[model samples]
Target: MVFVALLGTGTAVAGQVRGPAVVPLPPQPALPQLPWLPPLPPVPSISVQALPPFDVEPLDLDLESIGDSAQEAVLQSLQALGTLRESASVSVLGSLQDGFAFRFSQQQPPRDRTEARAEALYRSARESIDRGRYENAIQELDRLIDLPGTSRVDAALYWKSYTQAKLGQRAEALTTLADLEKRFANSRWLKDAKALEVEIRQASGQAVSPDSQNDEELKLLALRGLIQSDPDRAVPMIERLLDGNSSVKVQENALFVLSQSQSARALEIIAKTARGAVNPDVQLRAIRYLGAIGGPENRQVLDEVYRGSNDAALKRAILRAFMTGGDRARLLALAKSETSPELRAQAIQQLGVLHATTELADLYRNESSAEMKKRVLQAMLVGGDADRLIELAKSEKDVELRRAAIQNLGLMAAGRTGEALKQLYSSDASADIRREVINALFVQQNAGVLVDAARAEKDPAMKKEIVAKLSLLRSKEASDYLLELLK
Candidate 1:
């Protein structure tokens, strides 16, 4: 079967061809298109202009201070594996609140006393909170929170919420809209607050939806509005929808929208949803959610699911989750252990797409099953291991796997992958697999081999099909073979 590579940019995305590339069935599945998410209230946009403007002065961070153990960990974590990992990390880093305050005082009357004084004050306020110092903590937090949209906003909200909740003003805090809501109702966060209020109630075993919003439409509309207004707030609502009486649509929308909310809170809820989802749709959506909000935690959840799941589709979905999470190790491990040879092969193919070589290379080299190892080689090509893929096709045992590997060797039009296809042209094996090799060899642009195969072929039908294919990818070789056949 001819292997179809769904090349994105230039990466292979699928598997081993049997003979003729197995054409996919027609009829694309349709689902309901999602409604537009409600607009989120604007987040507190801190002006970078407030900070000292950049100069030629290089920004020096004391990377050494983080300790030696972190160095190796950081490197592995920051692997340049050409996955969307770098982009995902960039997205995550872009979202962190600027919690740090570079307290610059030109009038540093005493350098020694400044840190100590601030430390003392910070400590005193923190300790006061422990000792029923709500007012003191509030006072200190006020100054900290006021420093032009500081990272302490979450803390500020917490303190404000806590003080109000503690002082028997729980209803008010519950009903309270953030200042962002009052000042900028059009912003993303306002919608989040409305959604969050319902979620908070649900988490507390209080009624989650408004008394009037008993209908699914009303609840869904409210949720859609939430992610638009306040992703932070909407996240809780989405989680609650997952857990509550909401339909799968509401839950899916919440999950989908929260994935974009891109806050720690959103990530936290998505993790919980992935772990706790009973509905497969909910669980699968959870995978996409984790991918959208990728991290070690998200990776761990997918890995756990893959390890625990027996369903092939779910396993495939979980494999997809790992790709999104950028957990190569977990993905390869799952691939190796998958009971379904198809899933295992798919995992290997995906690694090829990722251009990850070593993860499956050695494991595949030692694979005992001919059919299985072939699957690995197919996977490797998809993953972008052109050089190794070429080598494996040359050295591989298990004739079936070797032939399968040969077919994909030229995945990236790696002209080199086809060299093996040259040798395979003469092999006396299944005509189907051999016919497949004809197409795979096209990567190396070997028209002559295909021409010879077509003319010298013993199977009339297989020869006809190969001739048709060889002509389709390019006409010269097949036409040459056709001319030779006519003689």
Candidate 2:
């Protein structure tokens, strides 16, 4: 007798379908199965062979097999990933046979290789010049000039000419200068090129007369050269130009040339011109030159002009000259004794420029006018005398003057002024003074201190003012303090 059984779906195991487990039924009493089972004609000796386990792996679709639509979808997904990650790694290849030809690479901008190379060569040339390697620099510059469309061509030509001149190749340098002039008519480098041409001509013993040049700038260059080569001759010509109806620029250049001379004649001419021997403008220039020359004699010359002159503008020029000459004693004398308020104020300002804090403090003590004292305070501030300013803020009896000192203190460096302001704020009970202190701290952006003051402050009005200031600030401390207030 045979028994038949039905099978249900099987389990998958390691890429192979497995048959379900079979169970044997308990042996039935013999009769019923034999009659019907003759049909189960001998489930004859059946033989089964288990097949080899099938191998499995992830599918790799060929690029050729991927459709255009599918490719676009994949590329878009990669682009989205790149955007989310803020990266440039995403790329799409056209085909496997094309061997990693990226479509995205075509969108990338090409680098300015020519510009980069030109810049490198130009820099190398400059470095070589600094090291006194003229020949090497010339080689690099030549290479740079050969590059097409280089913006530095004009600069290269100028430096090359300069290098050629340094090497005593005067004829070659002139040729290069001529080429630069022809190629770039409106180039800014032409000015320096002309100056260099004058220098080279002078070095070669060629004459360069100031009168020959039409351009004032070129004439100035020529005059400078003449001064160096023949000062006696140059001095007479300069004197003629100054005394003649030459342009003011020409006269100034002449004065500058004369100032460079150490001869007694030059000094006499400068002194004579300084004492109003010329127009007011030239007189002012002369005064400045004397001050710039700055010696016992020069100072004497300035003093002579100051004592002899009544023009307020002339006196002010003298005062500035004193500052330029670093003659603090002269400035102090004027600040103390000058009766003209405008002149006195000018003197005080000059002293401040000299940072003569001691002299300023003394002037403040002797000053009877509140206005003059206020000027003294301003001068002290300009001199960066924070210690004096702090003293004035603390002890000054005049409210306006005290407030002025506090405001100036705010303009100073915070490290020194911040603590001083905090101390003043705590000690002073006057709301106006405290408000000035708060404004000073605000200018310093000392939000941490403002927050502390707000918490400790009893007046609702002042607290609200501090909070309002904090609202305009973007600092983390201000924001955090505001958040705490919200809580």
Candidate 3:
């Protein structure tokens, strides 16, 4: 066998014998076939699922019905809380449970006839007195005094005595005063009655007793009464009191009498004491007198004292005196040129009371001191200078000054308040400024605008601030927005 073993083991043509006949590899097991999955449909750029149509049901609500229901509910709740009381059904006992309620009760008994007559007569007497009808006043006083069970009988008697004295009925006036003293010893008009008695006796050329002079209360009472009826006689005594012979109380009382008198002599004495009294107490009372008796003469005296005295406190008093006298020109001059900051500030405030808006604005524009500028802002607010305040809110450069202006703007009812606050909030990045803006908006009771601003805000801290402000609002819209935020 020619080794032709059928190209057996190794092929003879290739090489002698291959290392070994290559053993055929066994067939691999086939993989299980996966079910075909369609390619995921190309994702649409927009939602593929059909969206619900944009629609809103128009509200055809009956406002009347809703209002009625709301009102009914409120009434029911009030009833439950005991806030709804049937006034017509309230008995006296029930009304008295709330003691003050009895005063307003409609079931109150009608006024007694005698009491009504007394009140009518009293009113007539007052009107007659006001009209200088002393005879008519005396007639009404007599009728009122005779009305039985009238509480104003003593009051009527007192006025009758006054009317009698005014008519020069000395004996009749003395008799009336004596009856008032004997019958109504605890009357509120007792002191006045006694004073009138002393006045009657003095006018009648009767020797006044030491009891009237020794009793200080009686003395002051007598002096006040005499000043009203006999100013000529009272003037000398007033001068004596101002001369420091009497107690401080007596001097003060004398100053009061002078304040009421129209006598030029009295005014001269008052001005003298106010100008240069050794006793500061007397000077102070005299200064107050000039302020109370405000006129050109008093103003002149106040001005003189203000210029000559080195007392800062007294200078302040002069400013007040000018205020009381309505001396706007003097106040304007003081506010402009006074060296004392306190006095200047005080004058500015008085000018505000006088509504010196133009002068106040001028001072605000020209003022340099921060404290003084603060005072100007206050004065402008008091004077209702809204335009000036708005101007300051926009143009002021000092931070504190601006803040003060803005704060005062909150106090005012300026037409530009909302606009000014919005502008400040948008332009000023300061947290404090923004806070003030929010507070001002809150104070103005602006809910809708505030809510819109809050919704549009982007800054986290500022947005938080806006929400904080809105949270304080009582509006339904604000409440709804807050509920949404809670989610």
- Name the top lDDT candidate: 2
CA-lDDT, candidates in order: 0.52, 0.67, 0.63
Which window of ten consecutive residues has the lowest lDDT sum in model 2? 46-55
Which candidate achieves the best TM-score against the true structure?
A: 2
- Local accuracy of candidate 2 as per-residue lDDT tens digits, 218-308: 5556667787778887778777777755433356667887888777788889998998756555687899889878888989889989999
Q: Report how far residue 296 has shifted in candidate 3, in Å.
A: 2.0
Cα lDDT of model 3 by residue, 190-300, tens digit: 765776777677768988655332354455567777887998998887787567344333456667767777888888888988986434545766886687678887888
The digit string of per-residue lDDT tens for model 1 on 376-484 reads 6644544556677666656655555555555455333424444556565576365645655655544344566666666677888877656654544445656666666
Clashes of each: 33, 0, 0
TM-score, structure 2 vs. true: 0.55
Model 2 CA deviation exceeding 4 Å by range: 1-219
* Residue-pair clash count for candidate 1: 33
TM-score of each: 0.47, 0.55, 0.53
Candidate number that wins on TM-score, 1 or 2: 2
